[model samples]
Target: MLRIFVIVIIANAAMAQVPFLGTCPNLEAMQNFELERYLGKWYEVERYFAWFEFGGKCVTANYSLNENASVKILNKQISSLTGVATSIEGIARLIGRSDDPKLTVTFPSLPLPFDAPYWVLDTDYISYAVVWSCTNLGVLNVRNVWILTREPKPSVAVVEKAYQIIDKNNISRAYFIRTDQKNCPVTN
Candidate 1:
């Protein structure tokens, strides 16, 4: 009995550090995804807690075409406590097919040695986007999800639509936390 109790405690501790457990869900990426339409800025409305983005508010991601045909990604966030802004640049390359919404993103500034998956589960270029990434580690998985909108503060209808899409995919909305977009500092 004590051995079983110890095992359960260890499992819970491990899961507390990661985003999700069990095998990564088999979610589908957006079909016929158009990179051109997805370019420009997207404000994060909600997201799973990410260690890299701790204490960040008014998070936004901007994408543009690079000279080498890869997509250039710029993610900016303001410190909720300090009111200072910070940004990071990364490069994303299409993983398989040209139209696939799956890409590998590499942040050269970070200590990570390998590229991470950036998968678009669903998006309506003019309104909202759902991005998901998961890395399976044997018994547990590290998952990240972001609900993005073209506008910093999206309308209720828009948010409901995004939530409906997430529901269709059976992704839990429990772990997501809202990102503060009010009174954010303006940027060039």
Candidate 2:
């Protein structure tokens, strides 16, 4: 009975919004990260499934500097079914050294007790970026990943480069799904 209970709990946690498994992976954030160069719009090329992003398409995130020097986050997404556009604003601040690409992001719209990790695993600032986050929860860990590009529809070479980084990091590609960027509503 105890074994059965443990199996059930693990199964339930695995079905949560974020993928949960063993301890968090040993991954390093980008070193010598330039905040100024990374501050711009990034379109979602691919990502792990997220409940809050269900039915969302043409997802994009815009970053800028806030008055307090914290990074401002503006995430936008359009509904594939309803064609409705929605967005959320958030704040991000470095969690480590100035050049470290590790940060914590908080959305005032969500009633969460703490900020979520937003770590840039790799990036070239101009073409592509691989972002990853993991939280160790004792018996299990929750993980998230996103492959972003400066353009909504990046070339094959650009995407392949992003995949190379993911492969090098040994991150599983099973959960990634391409984001639909076709017929997206234009913004000025």
Candidate 3:
């Protein structure tokens, strides 16, 4: 009896997913729409909040574009104490943008964890920011967003540029914490 009850609870949790289920909020109607061109190793320019293991340290998200299936991510880990680098393996797949102009990507499964991450690409070719939304409802939107670039460390201009893009979206800049950058990446 106990086992059955536990299973039911788990199943219910999985059913409850982030808002919009599979759609981007606000600025949904953009001009061009392409996912492949946007996939690449983007440097962390400015982030709303230190996400994952990068609470206080500078963090970078290394994404390699693949044609096979899921996109792999080496979310570099930085040690705030000693200023070191570590890498973790993760996958991202377009979940919500299936039939819309916007898109959101998550790890493997969706909802079950109740933290399905969705990113809406702003208007830009090289620079792009993803508004990390856990639920479809904007009322509960928190600081889980990210701004990335092709380079490891962005120039002050680029950083500001990204910030402007995010700012235009109604996101608060004060809440955003810089990703761990003790070990900055090399640029092209």
Measured by TM-score, the strongest candidate is 2
List lDDT for all candidates, in order: 0.86, 0.87, 0.53
Residue-by-residue lDDT tens digits, candidate 3, 46-92: 55433345444555566665676556666665677666666666666
TM-score for predicted model 2 compared with the true structure: 0.90
**How well does model 1 score by local distance difference test?**
0.86
Ranking by lDDT: 2, 1, 3
lDDT, model 2, position 42: 96
Better lDDT candidate (2, 3): 2
Question: Residue 156 deviation, candidate 3, in Å?
Answer: 3.2
lDDT (10s digit) by residue, model 2, range 1-188: 99888777656445533756579888867789998899999999999877778889999999999889899999999999899999999999998888999999888887544577899989999999999987776678878899999999999999999999899899889999899999998873
- lDDT of candidate model 3 versus the reference: 0.53
Q: How many collisions per candidate?
A: 0, 0, 14
Q: If scored against the real structure, what TM-score would every candidate get? A: 0.88, 0.90, 0.64
